[model samples]
Target chain A: MPLPSDIEKSFAASLLDKDGRVPSDLTSYSSPVPQSRFNIYRNNVHVALIDMMAAKFPIVLKLVGEEFFRGAARVYIRANPPTSAMTINYGKGFPGFLENFEHVQDVPYLADVARLEWLRMEAYNAADRKSLGGEDLAAIDHDRLIETSFELHPSLRLLQSEYPVYSIWQANIDGVALSSVDLNSGGEDVLIIRPRLEVLVIKLASGHCDFVRALGSGIALGEANERAFESHEGFDLQLAISGLIGCGAFTGFSK
Target chain B: MTNLSSWLDKPIPARAGVGLKPEHFAEILDTEPDIGWFEVHAENYMGDGGPPHHFLSLIRERYPLSIHGVGLSIGGEGALDAEHLKRLKTVVDRYSPGLFSEHLAWSTHGDIFYSDLLPLPYNEATLETVVAHIDQVQDVVGRQMLLENPATYVTFKSSDMAEIDFLREIVARTGCGLLLDVNNVYVAGTNHDYSPQAYLDAFPFEHVGEIHLAGHAEARDDAGARVLIDAHDRALVDDVWALYERVISSGVSVPTLIEWDNDVPSWARLFSEAQKADRILKGAQTEDAVAV
Candidate 1:
């Protein structure tokens, strides 16, 4: 018979528990001793996965000190154990977890910073494609330009936050000097893309984020212009399109 | 069977190879160090297309690559992870590595992946289970996979066989080569109160295709029992170097790796470690040449 789901969960929980014992039924020995060695294995697994999270999200850990970060991570891990052994992209729910966590409610921007880091990681590993060039844009007749739809680069990701997440990320970087960051400095829109082989996050101007978002959502060029115009009255379509192209944001276009 | 012989039996050059950490992408591309080969965790490169693929493609062109997997769970009670196996096979098919290896340990049980390499009782049950898993993995990848001995902390009372015997039986049954981790032998020996020398002596040297040298952390158990933990990326321990020398004397022409995945020092430090192993390989070759 297959192992029962609850029994398996209990078994895993027992192994991860600080004072829990390995089930006597699993082994043939009669010592009735606690599964101490198994607990060591369990601890190692948890620490390794936690370390991966810590590596990927260093700024998040730095925002919350080591003690609090690990404590919070332990809780998050038990609640949401990895669905796959491949942990390169695991811990996707960390940002949401931080938002709901009551301990760090004072630092409201923690989850947003985590979301930025996760987006950076995602862009770095997103699919590779041939980026559309400026010459391709010239191929279209000027009359057909606004009606054409464009496909954004596979690696393009937009992160809109109500806090200065970019400043938070920068201040906490390894070599950067730490300083008092302003919490109420309004909101920020960030553009994350892997143009070459590395993920680059560029802070977007207040009005340009809507342009990228509209373009990224596969809206027609005319509709994207309308959206950008609505948000920023004098939004320049030429400047935004050139910026997106230079950043390798569009892979191709469709009329 | 097609071109598998050349791959499994090919020799590795004596130059240094990096562990393929993502942090060094620009440095690796800029310097283009004359690295012998690059080794990476198989799971890392399983994605379809990304920076991992780009960097790997660039480096693969310049150096030999090896896929050292940590998640195969070769000794698990349940069936082998077929999806993970298929992903790994796709990678191997894409990049024909000079060597491919997995641990003689399990990591998953009914989808509750204990991401660490958990130990199994070295007995009939485990032996059969691992051998079957290795066979399945090899069949899928279409190549012989090297099995590295686990760096164990504790042994179960139900373990009816020695670790070496268990390894030998697997190799014999599956025709797989052994990735002899001298540090693991030394660490497991110290942990279990056995002789590292005896473990080495009992190892099937002819079947060892590659060797691993890494640093370990030594600590005491709850009951004050001394043991060594194989934390792979630390500074090289003095005794592990001695163990490497002893293994080189075994007359096996095996490619060795100076693995440092944690606390990774500078590129120069990793190269120096590899150079140290290179020296040992040459010394063994020199002695053999003089005897001839």
Candidate 2:
């Protein structure tokens, strides 16, 4: 860490620093390089991460608006500066950042909305695997099915939030008028999966979330069913399996 | 592992290619436009099998492909991220792209990744660092990579040698190919108040294996001096087109690509830019045939 090392550290620091400062060794053909020239590197770094965050969390951007969203994104980008160049993995901590981001506290549901968006992004880029279709699950013998444990798709994500995050995400994504949905209606259990290239965000029924979670954690199908039944009186095993299978949730199952 | 000799062959035909964008993925598959090749940022396709890989697989099957890595930070001050190198190798092994390339710039320092290609000074200490990194990259990826020059606004006061000399020395030491980006030369030349033609005259065209042509945004410095940003949002300006022709005229007819990373245009618009390069290359092809 000598000549170029000292220069890079300061240059990297100035890019993410709250106070805009130019590195000392920087020069131009002219006697003194204009500040704007050095600021180009600064702008490129900030603008790239900001744009990446803005693109990944569109629903959050809509809720907060561009001005506020970008302003907050600027601060978030600095505080949680990416350690990897993988833009997909850059904002994994953004939802948590928004949770404690003071200015958006009035909008208590903002962090949850951000969490839903982050999950959707994760689903989009997750590993590829052929999902176990409903027919495949049905073809299993009834006696063996009970003891079988299911392997969920690699892209499956379950998000439980106190805010009606699914509705907020759905409304914004579909470009529908938000007046139809009440933000304070109730919390939501979201099941996001991408069996193929298409990503699906499903609003889970009361007991299905626990059932799916249990199955995902290697519990036997029969035991998962029993857990679902205990979780809520409205639990219907047939309906839950049909819905999840219809959406290609499970990748495989083993006895 | 790819054979180093075969990697140096540069199998990508001396025709025009376009940067692949997800927005136009379906259209590209459906239309199957006549493109020389397609180049993608290795980081974009580092994601596991999904639409990016799905579409790239389809396109790679039809045409020659090049994987341009934007985030290896080859010129970084610290040790190169072995994980990032592994990711780059994975993508290369999956597709076996015709050309593999990265920048002469560093984007990450310490634990922070900037997500932008930050410029580095051209000097012995920095040169040793870059040469070692490129050597590590070629050894790990098991391929000959092309190193592209960066478009910079500021130069280091400590830089003892010129950019061309640094590039030539790196090529001599590492034996890697060069991806000569015409617009970058124009942009850097104007930004630094240097003659791009002079830089081109000094370039080691023998080691050059590919060409990159793109559009840059015009801006002004704080002192009101003209500065150009490598903003690949729009079409190539007439001046950059001339620079591309100049490179072709210099007997360096290589696989050219039109890179529109920001504000990506329609498939028709992007492909047409590639076609424009094809027209220029074709014109030079006829002249070379006559010369031969």
Candidate 3:
């Protein structure tokens, strides 16, 4: 008789391989077809994991259609089984999986869309905190403000992609009328945050993206604005600051 | 000891309650149905703070709550995951659910997690592993947990014991209670060609802390034999209802739960199912009173 760990290892391996045989130690009451009965478990595991991925990446499923999405998801799940029992945390590798997926090469933008969806899920579940307001920013002295670095909200996420992922995500998820997007219209940068309870995706100017990315990494205000100005020709510090504040991106600050 | 005493003090009433789904949050809060208690999957509320916790807090204020965990994998061969246990402890401390329960089957091996409850061979070795796992869980959570019997489609040849004996021994060793899932009994009974009644008769219902009744899907096995899958996506079948009535009539009226996970129906439909179970519970109480 095999040890319990040996049986478990074999069972886990067999769940991913179709030609894998059921362990000889297993038996049914009436029939000798343990292999046939084992298919039920294999099918259950696959279907459950595939459904979890589908729920996590609905826009990815929508782009690939159900049949293709299921096929791709099966491949992804076989390669990367969940490490945690929480289904919500199951698809952390899915966006990367789509990038290397041979079948999805035609839709190069699919991976970014998956990334957007994953970010939205993260933002939705991120720790809740009271956001800072415009008045709070105004309360700071000018000299100290330059030396102060603001803390971004826990729910805030920044993304820069080589495609117009924001428009594509909106079109697919919101059921907006599909319109042709210019691939040559430069790369897009987006800021995702949950201000209240709803996750909001805001398109950011290149300069603002640079500024927020720097500040998010603990850079002081003056240095962050300098990097923003160097990145874009017309970087408006006041406009960027006000826009991020309105989106509830910052929580508090320290010198 | 103090924590355990506090947990034991708030016992869920012996009536019917439905699994709380996010879809019915508004209706439940608005109508305030006379539910016995509410049960939630512990994994669903592991997040820091969101709508899941927001609504659950309001609902918990009104009714007694039970945390039914599906991810603990207590029957696995290796040591239980420490991080998973810590998260579970956090939730347990936060909610202080009247009853905490997990399945008898394993869902993880090494780092790979199969979300569904997978079957285990019933033998001395496996029994020892499970008892130890339960002991570890109980020690960490600071309270006793109810171990639920699993619905199996396949049996192992290496098994040297019966399911009832395995459960009985688990309770004897670790001092844990049982969460008798009646639908699982019916499903496993039909799939394995055993008498559900006989299984129930041999079961040690004295250790039962809660009861679960759910729906199963009907399918044919490879040999063209009839089998039932514990789907939990539909209403309870007539046969399962009959078995539940049998359990109640036998003077084992525990806290019952109506589990509807997938293809969730409207608030009215789900509440009606609970109402049906509630009526049976009332009938059982009346019978006991008359006997007394």
User: Which candidate gets the maximum lDDT versus the true structure?
Assistant: 3
What ranges in model 1 sit over 4 Å off?
A1-13, A20-39, A171-181, A231-234, B5-11, B14-18, B23-35, B48-51
Interface RMSD of each: 5.1, 2.1, 1.4
Order the candidates by lDDT, highest first: 3, 2, 1
lDDT of each: 0.79, 0.89, 0.89
Residue pairs in clash, model 1: none
Model 2 misplacement above 4 A: A31-33, B1-10
Native contacts present in each candidate (fraction): 0.35, 0.80, 0.72
Q: What is the lDDT of residue A44 in candidate 1?
A: 80
> How many clashes does each candidate structure show, in the order listed?
0, 0, 0
> For every candidate, how close is chain A to the native chain A in TM-score?
0.89, 0.95, 0.95
Q: Candidate 1's residue-wise lDDT over A53-157, tens digit each?
A: 887788889878887888888888878777677777688999999999999999999999999999888887787888888998888778988888889888888
Compared with the true structure, what per-residue lDDT tens digits does model 1 show for residues B1-292? 2256658544457444557777776678889876577788888887657878888889888778888998887877778778888888888878888888999887777766767887777778668878889889888988888999988765555577888889889988999989888899888888667889888888899888778888987665555566577888687788888877887886765677878888878777787787778778889988999999
C-alpha displacement of A234 in model 2, angstroms? 1.3
- In candidate 3 the C-alpha lDDT for residue B284 amounts to 91
Off by over 4 Å in 3: none
- Local accuracy of candidate 2 as per-residue lDDT tens digits, B1-292: 3475656544789999999898998888888898888899999988886788888888888888899999999988899999999999999988888899999999989998999999888899999999999999999999889999889998887788899999999998998989999899999999999899888888899988888888899888877889999999999999889877888987888899999999989889898889999999999999999999
**Residue-wise lDDT of candidate 3 within A1-255, one digit each (tens)?**
788778888887787786868877677775676766787788889999999888889988888899999999999888889998877788989999999999999899899999999999898888888899999988888978778898999989988999999888878777975466665666798999997878899998768889999999999899999989987979999999999999999899984
